[model samples]
Target: MMDSLEGEELCYPLLLNVSCRGLMRPRFEAILLYTLFSSITVLTVALNLMVIISISHFRQLHTPTNLLLLSLAVSDLLVGVVVMPVETVRFIETCWLLGDVMCALSYIIGFTLTSASVGNMVLISIDRFVAICYPLQYPNKITRSRIEVSVCLCWACSFLYNGLILKDHLRQPDRYNSCYGECMVVINYISGTVDLVFTFIGPCSIILILYIRVFIVAVSQARAMQSHITAAAARKVPVTAKKSERKAARTLGIVILVFLMSFCPYYYPSLAGQDISNDASSWAIVSWLLFFNSCLNPIIYAFFYPWFRKAIRFIVTLKILEQGSSQANIL
Candidate 1:
């Protein structure tokens, strides 16, 4: 009878182990995708950091817009640093080894930096729109103090809202939803729902509306410029400044397009939720795509800015010369 009881007791864990092992196929595929995605993201992040550092170190690129670009680069770099590393580890292993405390820290840091970056983008978009449309008032309206205050407010809001999650939660074992594995590590279903609304839906809606208004305003400005040029020619005046404004508008449009492309995949999975099958393969693909955003910014620069190519060339040359010198010294 004792031997019979032992056999029954062993059967339960054995069954569970087999079931969990069956789930491993999808998880293994996810690990491969995470590896590829994280590699690319890290490379892109490295390039962005170089660009930001080089620009700041070289005084020639010190325009207000470049300053904003620098800020965006910093935020993107932080996302790669604070969010992607832990996320990649979790996705690949299908577990969270960092415990609840670290997971909470990851949650807060990632949320705050990403939100701040998004907020800064909105502010920069408005600044560009105003600068192009109302050149006379732009200087007075967008002073250094005002920009600083706006940046501070963005940070403050990000911290307060993201920090709200940290208050009531810790890495306690009770909070772990073993069913979802690492997917439910940092947050539960209820908090995850809240995160989806606040982080993805709310911010995305505001950005979309703002960008729409910006596009409309840009169209109107173009029409006005065409009319102004016709009147200027009649009055025998030059229209050189309008041409410059048009070039800047084109650059801004490209930036907006890149931002949308990079962020869409990241938010799509959250919006899809359980409807998307919660299967490992689909989740892995979406997760990697989102992580791709950190790396996409560097690609954006290469596509849109000739200066970035020059910067890359400079970096390569420097590295080659440094390596050559090291070899000579070793010899």
Candidate 2:
């Protein structure tokens, strides 16, 4: 009876000696958690996929700003497709059945995509700052080729940076595993601090500074435009274009604010001088909160863009499949 009871708790009953113990949560609770996270994963993927399809299919949406948004959507999609399901299984099952290699790769991929997403946000801020601050130079400064190069560099740097951050874990995938079936990655306080600074503080600082400048310039421009635009000038289309740019800047501001809120809790341990561990008791809530940001980005950021609304209509109605849909007026 003792042997059978031990078997019930062990992840691998046959290899009892080295097998890790599993969670003792009731079956119903585990199922409920699984169902909930699965739904989130699906929603995140579906929403981000819509953004991708919308931007990619419509020629009018092929501007440099949308290209940055496209990069962000791709990263968020990977988070949903790769990171969310893996984490859900790791947390709910409390067993790392996929083995050591997968354990390492999963985190590497997750962190890289996350860093890339941050980089994309920074680029978006810079794009807006240029547009709002120097309207005449915006087109020349934020070109498609320049944004493309910047995006490629952002992703490449992310991969390299995260690889260094998780070098030890990648080198020895089972280094932190206490027993078989366990998956744990611990970032020592030193590494965690460095990560917090680069991944959170540094990038966020740049984004904050740029957006502040953008906001100041935007306000001045708004006031000037309002005072200077005569009824005859307002009747022309030029005034409307400037107003549209201001609206987009406001929308992206909300995206950055949500990004900060989602990220702050996950780094709280580091803030408190503790090493970051994936297996911590509080990890579930904070980590899922960060992942939940991926689901919210599309709704919060893209939903405000009128073109996205119109694109979704075309897509949902299958009108996007018709000939010359790629040339459709999305903006």
Candidate 3:
């Protein structure tokens, strides 16, 4: 009985000397957590997959902005498919059973998806900035081909940047492990600081600045539309186009706000001049908050974008499988 009890406490009981401790959550709590996170994983994947199909299958939805949304959905889909499952096991089990190589790859995948998400947000903000601030020039400035190239660059840069940052971890997966059943990576102070600036601070600064400008321009345009003189003078302007731009700006604005809220806590340790430790007590909560952003994104789209609703209806009803459905007017 004592041996069994002791064995239960170790993640790898046969190698007790090198094993990390097993999590000891109450049965009820463990079940609840598993249910909750599993739902999130499923929802995130399904919702983002819907977004992917909606954008990709509909010819009418192939705008430059929607292409960026598609890129963002792909990154979110990866988070749901790859990062969330592994992270759920890591957090709930509180021990690594997947081996050192899997550990390194998980961290790399997580970082790459995160970086790509941030990159997509930056691109979306720039797209909105151009649309709102220079509506007349938006078409010429942002094209389908340009957006495609930019999306490719965003993903490629994410992979290259994260690989560079986590090169040591990749090469020596067990370098930071103190025991066989502990999966963790440690970033040195210098590299951590650089990552903080580049990944969080720099990107966030650009997002905030561009969004602030977008907000200012949108507000001014609203006020201008309300003015009789400005409205009459610009009567030749396409009101429908202006309304579309304003609506898109509002939807993307909410996305940026939610992203900022979800990610801020995850980086609080870095902001406070502390090394980011994956094993910290609050790490799981903050990390989940960040991951939860991926799930929330598709929900935001559903709530804000009418086309997404129509697409979901068509998708769920099997209408998308019909011939020539791709050319159906989704807008």
TM of each candidate vs. truth: 0.67, 0.90, 0.89
User: Which ranges of candidate 2 are over 4 A from the true structure?
Assistant: 1-8, 229-253
What's the TM for model 2?
A: 0.90
Q: Write the per-residue lDDT of candidate 1 for residues 191-224, one digit (tens) a residue.
A: 5567667766666666566555666666666656
Q: Candidate 2 residues 1-331, lDDT tens each?
A: 6665553578788988999877567889989999999999999999999999999888899899999999999999999999999989888886778989999999899889888988888898889888878889998888999999999999999999999999999999999888999888999889889989989999889988887787677666665676677777776646665775677567657766787898999888889999899888888898888888889878876887899999999999999999999998777
TM-score of 1: 0.67
Candidate 3 lDDT, 1-331, residue by residue in tens: 6665553677788996888777477789889999999999999999999999999899998899999999999999999999999999888886788988999999999989988988888898899889979999999999999999999999999999999989999999998788889887877677777888878888888888887888777767765655644546567555654785677567657866787788888777777777777868898898899889889877775447789999999999999999999988878
Q: Supply every candidate's count of residue pairs whose N, Cα or C atoms clash at under 3 angstroms.
A: 1, 0, 0
- Stretches of candidate 1 above 4 Å error? 1-35, 171-174, 179-183, 186-198, 220-283, 298-310, 319-331
* TM-score rank order: 2, 3, 1
Candidate that scores best on TM-score = 2
Displacement of residue 325 (Cα, Å) in model 3 is: 1.7
- Candidate 1 positional error at 138, Å: 1.7
